[model samples]
Target: MKALVLSGGAGTRLRPITHTSAKQLVPVANKPVLFYGLESIAAAGITEVGMIVGETAEEIQEAVGDGSQFGLKVTYIPQEKPLGLAHAVLIAREYLGDDDFVMYLGDNFIVGGIADLVEEFRTNRPDAQILLTQVPDPRAFGVAELDPSGQVVGLEEKPQQPKSDLALVGVYLFTPAIHDAVRSIEPSWRGELEITHAIQHLIDASAEVRSTVIKGYWKDTGNVTDMLEVNRTVLETMERRIDGEVDEASETIGRVVIEKGVRITNSRIVGPVVIAAGSEVSDSYVGPFTSVAENCRIADSELEFSIVLRDSSIRGVGRIEASLIGRHVEVTPAPVVPSAHRFVLGDHSKVQIRS
Candidate 1:
């Protein structure tokens, strides 16, 4: 089976950051989210793959060139626009001709991987197989309602009134028959043909559509909140190692990894943290659940539960938590000045005084 990884969507939810970078390339535990999907697919024994990319095609092309790094040969399939998941299937028809394929959304994080799912699909060979999980807000995702016989009876995308808490996870397995299903459906009210609609077409036509509800952790890292949460989750499982430099004056606590070329001096770093290459932490406190990327500088600052990208700096800042700081950025204390009283008094005796 071939793997079709979707990296095309314009991530509007992760704005400001996505404005400059692709959402799939966002780091969790110092590795890109898309890389996790590629590696997982490789481990599943799928090597012939295609990646669907959008305006940020060049960025992905550079990072995943030829896909040989992950033991896969990749073909770049460009989607002019991120119309819908159905549209992606439509465009990749030639590459996926007559073969079963697994479609993975780039920004989705699935803990415990999809190895078992692939094995099940290969054995059963269903027309379509979807991964489902019980989410608190089913209306926010593609939801599936089951029949009394445990079959998928209905599916809806971001519906206002959802029928079930079972949200469709980002991974899907489909047979060649799905090509006709995509062509048979009309665009939805959103002006694009949704994959859910296409899958519904298959179900209505009596095609076998199976679903597996997972108990493992899964997240669509489409926003800052989810991104940070995934980062923390991945960091929690990091193996304990100190592979790089640490000065005598620096105290390296449990499970800290200082990558090659990293220098730490006069700093207190508690781990389950990774400090990337060429980064220097001097006179700072680098706490747990944080990843400091390459060529960064942290001086006289304290950071915890945060992610700092390459070429960034944090100096003289008191503390930071649960932040996703971008590349080439700087965070430092504001200018110090003499104290002066400034007060505001409002109704009900509400007052804020700043000095």
Candidate 2:
């Protein structure tokens, strides 16, 4: 079996940062989100992978050269545009051929991995097997409707009135039967051929469509909040290892992993934190659930529940929490100046001020 991973799409939700890098390349726990999916695929015993890339093709190619590092032979399939999930399968027809393949979204993170799901699909060999999870807001995702027997009956992509609370997860298992379904369906109002529609087509055609409601942790990592959450989840499992230099004035607690070449002086790091190589943390407080990427500097500041990308520096910036700082960015204290409150108000307008 082969794997088809979608690494395209303009991540408008993660603006500014996405403008500079692919969403799939965003780091969670100092590792690209795409790498997690690729590692899952390898663990599932799939060796050949066809990665779908768009505008950020060059960057993806450079990072995942030959895919040998993950024990898989990768073939880069360029998509001129991110039409839709179904469109990705349509274009990868040749690469997928007649072999059963798994379609994974590069930016999605599932805690336990898809090895078990892959095994279930291999055993049953259904025409199409989709993963679903109960989401608080089903309107933002492709939702599936099930019958009294818990069988999938209908599917919709970002429906105005969703039929069910089960949102489709990023991983999908499909056989050769899906080719015809992709060709038969028309694009939705969004002018894109959604995968939900393709799967619905299979249901309408009486083909076997199966689904598994997963209880494991899964995240799309599309926005700042979700990115930080996934980072915290990954860091929770980290083991305590201090390979770097920590001065006697410094102290670290909990599951902290300090990579080589890192220096910590007069700083206190509470664990479930990871400080990557070549980073320096001095006279700072690195709180729990924070990830400091490579070559970063944190001095005279307090950071908690934040992710600082590579080459970024946060010095004397008081306390920062629940943030996703991009690469090569500098964050420092603002210049001290006179404090004053000036306001222009209209009739009946009210204001609340806090210092």
Candidate 3:
């Protein structure tokens, strides 16, 4: 079986970071989100892979050139635009010819890998198989409705009123039979051929459409909040390894991995944190669930539950939390001004001021 990875999207939700970089290239735990998906695909013993790329095609190609790093041979398929999921499959028909393939969204993070899912699909040979997870907000995802017997009976993409909380996860498995389904379906009102519609077509034709409700963690890191959450989740599994230098003035506690060339002086780092190579943490409080990427500097600040990208520096900032700092960014304290309150009082107006 082959794998088709979708790495193209406007990523408007993550702007202005996405303005400068592909959303798939955003790092979680100092590693690109797309890399994780590629690694997962390789782990499933699939070596021949096709990548669907869009406007940020060059960037994606540069980062994942040849895909040999993951022990896979990658073929790049260019999409003029991110029409939809089914549209991606439509263009990739040549590369995916006559072969069952796994479609993985590059930016999505599934805690457990897709090895078991691939194995199940190979064993069952369903026409199409989708992974589903219970989500609080079903309207934001493609949702599925199962019958009393737990069979997939209906599917909708971003419905206003969902029939069920079971939303489709980013991973999908499909046989060559799906080619006809894609050709038979019409574009939705959004002018894109959604994959959910194609799956619904199969359901109407009495084809074997299967669903697996995964209880493991899954997230689409398309926005800042989700990105930070996924980062924290991945960091939670990190083992403590301090290969860097920590001065006597610093205190490191809990499960923190300090990569080589790191220097910590007069700073305190809490558990489940990862400081990448060549970073310097001095006179700061690095709290839990934070990842400081390579060559970064943190001084005279307090940061927690945030991701600081490579070459970024945070100095003299009092406190920061739940933030996604991009690469080569500098954060510093705002200049102080004299305290004053100036106001023009209107007639019969009462005001109270704190001195």
Candidate models: Cα lDDT each: 0.92, 0.96, 0.96
Runs in model 3 lying further than 4 Å from the true structure: 346-351
> What is the alpha-carbon RMSD of candidate 3 to the true structure?
1.1
Put down candidate 1 lDDT per residue, 1-355, tens digits, no spaces.
Answer: 9999999989999888888899999899899999999999998989999899999999999989999999999999999999899999999999999999999999999998899999999999999999999999898999999988889999999999999999999999999989999999998898887999999999999999999999999999999889888888888888777777888998988878888899899999998898999999999998888999999999998999998999999998888888899999999889989877665766789655553
State the lDDT of candidate 3 residue by residue for 210-311, as single tens digits: 999999999999999999999999999999999999999999999999999999999999979999999999999999999999999999999999999899
| 1 against 2, candidate with superior lDDT | 2
Query: Each candidate: RMSD to true structure?
Result: 2.7, 2.7, 1.1
lDDT of 2 by residue, 14-120 (tens): 88999999999999999999999999999999999999999999999999999999999999999999899999999999999999999999999999999999999
Per-prediction TM-score, please?
A: 0.95, 0.96, 0.98
True-structure RMSD for candidate 2: 2.7
Which residue pairs of candidate 3 clash? Answer: none
Better of 2 and 3 by TM-score: 3
Pick the TM-score winner. 3
